[model samples]
Target chain A: MIRAEKIFKNFGDQAVLKGIDFTFEAGKTNLVIGKSGSGKTVLLKILVGLFQPTSGNIWYSDINLVSADKESLRKLRMEVGMLFQGNALFDSMTIEENIRFPLDMFTTKTLKEKKDRVNYCLERVSLEGNNNKFPSEISGGMQKRVGIARAIVLNPKYLFCDEPNSGLDPQTSITIDELILNITKDNKITTIINTHDMNSVMEIGENICLLDKGKLAWQGSKDEVLISKNEVLHDFIFASPFLQKLIENSK
Target chain B: MNLNLFYHFGNFVIWQAQIFKRPENGSMYYKETVRQMYDIGIGSLPIVFLISIFIGAVTAVQFYYQMAGSLIPAYYIGYIVRDMTIIELAPTITCLVLAGKVGSNMAAEIGGMRQKEHIDAMEIMGVNTSAYLILPKLIASLLMIPILVCAAALIGILGAYIASVPAGLFSSAEFIKGVRSFFIPYNVIMMLVKAFVFAYILTGVSCYQGYFVKGGSIELGQASTRAVVYSNILILLADYIIALILTA
Candidate 1:
């Protein structure tokens, strides 16, 4: 589990996150949903230790991530996996090389063992037999899966995905969401996703935190999304007239 | 101005400390250093060769003109060219050219990675990105730049021979005699010291500019430009300082 207590992040005079407090539960798909400029990315970056909160404490289970020393932070990083918005695969490296990078850097596995592990990770992401392909040669969805393969090759205890479904088609997006959800359940790892996809919220959002203008405006499950009386949530989620009409007709 | 200089100086010092941290994998660093060595040394050879040849030719021609009416021996032209190329021109000019070519390239490459979030990816993976990215380049430049400067010095002498001997500015024997005359080995030492110092300045300043880059493509381009500009300026500055200290 990861906990953020009274998190505040500022950029110059502009505040990006204001006193956010939340618990991301383990063995579950936790989603942070917000509109543009709602501090979702900043909050996610802070949670992943890419950004430091101006005032707050972040706890990874019993470890205080905020105060962890360099060595401790490195140990913590070994347990953390992140899938970036752009996939962040080394373009010059083949998929197999990319997937095996962390293992190569951190582990003393023999060549055959490393190759076997890379193959297993590729198969887990359904990217088997594509090991020799470069990132540009594959589709965006495949690249994201390769990114996931690389992220989980280390078998991290915590996984974070930023805008995982941003550039995928609806069908592909559903597949990615299902992949993340299944991985979270299978590994019982704490998984946090930053997304604006409503389908993701309704499908895999077992626990959701909604940020509005850098503040937590709503928190609930998918079950409460349609029934909630929160005007901001309603306006933001069903901003399209068609979605609003569909919800009204359903009611 | 002083405060700004102090600010960057402090940051550069801290950045060096980060870059010298223990490597996560020694073999990986070795492979990267070899790659960097090939890129910096072999990839840079053609341009360095082209420039050094011309520098030798121009120095010979200009000095020949100056020596034409003077009572100074025609052989002195070869001696002057040989000494100038060995003591100053080859190392300094070759490095300045590399400061533009290799330095800007390192800046753009690293700055692009930062913009693309590749550095963050490595950092999150328990990798000390500063060390991983910069150390190999440093090692490669330290080893390769001196070799390149040496090659540049030899080629420059050959260039002086080609220009002066073919142009009939002096007899081949006189030119050869002049080159063989007044050979001070310490001048070779001075040249090498300048090469090492300039190599460090260019690579360090370039890596520093790129590693801390922020914002988007526009900012990345600006960082690359700054890398080249700052490296050239610093290399020249170091050249002057080394010359003063060594020559004095």
Candidate 2:
């Protein structure tokens, strides 16, 4: 479990995350959802140590990430994996090579062992035979899967995904979401996903934190979303007329 | 402007500390260094050759015209070309050209990676993005730029010979004699020192520009331009300083 306590982030005079206190539980798809510019990405970045909060403590279990020293941070990062919004796969590398990168960097495994791990990751992502293909040669959905394969190749304890469903078709987005959800459950990984996709928030948002204008506006599960009286959450989730109508009809 | 300069210099010094840390994996760095060697060294050969030959030919032809009826022998043109190429033109001009070519390329490549979140991805994977991205290029430049400068010097001398001897401005024997005369071995050492310093400046400046780049393609383009411009200016400045120190 990762706990963010009173996290306050400011860029210059502009505050982005205002004293956000939350806990992301282990083995669950913990979602940080909000509209654009709602500090979702900033909060995610701070949690992952890409950006330091102006004030607060980020407790990755017992360790305080905000005060961790260089060696400790490096060691901690080895246990962490991230899937970027853009997928961030090395364009120059083949799918197999991309998946094997972490292992190659951090392990003493022999070539055969590394190759075996790469194949296993590929198979796990259901891209089993697409090893030699480049990222550009694959579809966007396939690229997202490759990103997931690379992320999980190292068997990280903590997984952070930033906008995993952006630019993906709704059908493909569900597939990616299921893949992440299953991976979290299977590995017991503490997974944090930052997205504004309402479909994702409704579908696999086991634990969701809603941010409105840099403050935590609402927090609950997918089950609580429909019955929640949080105005910020309602405005965000049912902002579109179609979604609002669907909710009324279902009621 | 002065404050900004200090700020950048301070940041650059601090950033270098990050880049020279012990590698997470030696073999990975070694492989990257080899790849960078091919890119910065072999990939730069044709341009270096083309520039060096033109520099030498122009110097020879211009010197020949200047000394046509002077008391100085025609052979002095070859000697002058040789010395000039070795002491100044070869290292300085070659590095200036490379600052535009290899340096800018490094900036664009790393800047593109930054814009694409590749560097952040590596950082999240526990890789020292600074070291992994810049060190191999630095190592490659240190190892390759001097060799390229030496090649440029030799090719420049040959260009002088081809322009002068074959054109009947002087006999092959006179040009060869001039090249053989006043062979200051110390000047070659000076050339090498300039090459080493220029190599560091170009690689470090370019990589620094790229690694810290922010924003979109327009910003990246500006960073690339700054890499070449700053590298060239620093190379020339260092060339002067080195020349003074060594000559003194």
Query: Which prediction has the highest TM-score against the true structure?
Result: 2
Worst 10 residues of 1 chain B by lDDT: B231-240
Chain B TM-score list for all models: 0.98, 0.99
Write down the C-alpha DockQ for each prediction: 0.89, 0.94
- Look at candidate 2 and give me any clashing residue pairs: none
lDDT tens digits, residues A36-122, model 2?
Answer: 999999999999999999999999888899999988898889899999999999999999999999999999999999999999988
TM-score of each: 0.98, 0.99
Point out where model 1 deviates above 4 Å: A248-251
Each prediction's Cα lDDT score?
Answer: 0.93, 0.94
Tens-digit per-residue lDDT, B1-248, candidate 2: 99999999999999999999999999999999999999989999999999999899889989999999999997888799999999999999999999999999999999999999999999999999999999999999999999999999999999888887788888898888889999999999999999999999999999999999999999999999999999999998998899889999
lDDT of 1 by residue, A141-178 (tens): 99999999999999999999999998999999999999
Native-referenced TM-scores of chain A, all candidate models: 0.97, 0.97
**How much is B84 displaced in model 1, in angstroms?**
0.6
List residue ranges in candidate 2 displaced over 4 A: A247-251
